[model samples]
Target: MKNKNVFNYLKQLHADNAEYKEQMAELKKLPHEYQVVYKEIQNFLWEFTSGDGMDMLQPMYGLLDFFKEGAGNQVPVLDLVGEDVGEFAETMLHEIQAKTRINELKRKMNERVKKEINQNK
Candidate 1:
């Protein structure tokens, strides 16, 4: 019974990891404009989940608003260009990977805790 639970948990973790990896790969292939927004979303989500010192949803939505404005021609192209854009892109990608690892660690820790609980029971 314990083996079954362990196996199921591992399987779910693997699936979740794979799905996130695929999503990241797809995001990487997007054009520069869309990619920036996608990366920001990933960053915000990761930071939010990992107890970062920021209002995740608000900043994320704000970024979305910026993207939307750009798309609608309300924001100029210069707004999303330059060295800052490159830096942001790099930082966002790094955060995504970091967050993925953190989530995996958390999942493993939870599994360990569950195993202990089950054994105690």
Candidate 2:
């Protein structure tokens, strides 16, 4: 007789791995800053993975609004299962914008400091 338990376990493992690979591929397609944001959101989602679906709803809706602001309004929230994966995508978009703004401020501040030092020299 076939060992159905081991066979099922192996099959399930393969399916899980495939899903992970697909998600990785999607992340790789994003710009570098957005990829960093996606990973951060992934970490945030990790904690809620074992929690109830209700717990994720608030965060998911917050994420959906982030997407809606950025042209991802078309992303279907209902079609997503478990914790909404849209959170990862949308958070990345918003985070990347924030990072860009911060970087610009840093550059301007650095330029001012350099100008001050050059004047003192």
Q: TM-score for all predictions?
A: 0.40, 0.39
Deviation of model 2 at 25, angstroms: 1.6
Task: Tell how far residue 116 is off in model 2, in angstroms.
Answer: 69
C-alpha lDDT of residue 80 in model 1: 59
Instruction: Tell me, by TM-score, which candidate is best.
Output: 1
Give the per-residue lDDT digits (tens) of candidate 1, residues 1-121.
9999999989976876685566556545445666665565555455435444222333444445556556566555346544466566555545444444456578899999999999999
> Across residues 1-121, which tens digit of lDDT does each residue of candidate 2 receive?
3789889978976876685676566556544544554455655654434323233333544543443343244433333222555654455445434333345567789999999999999
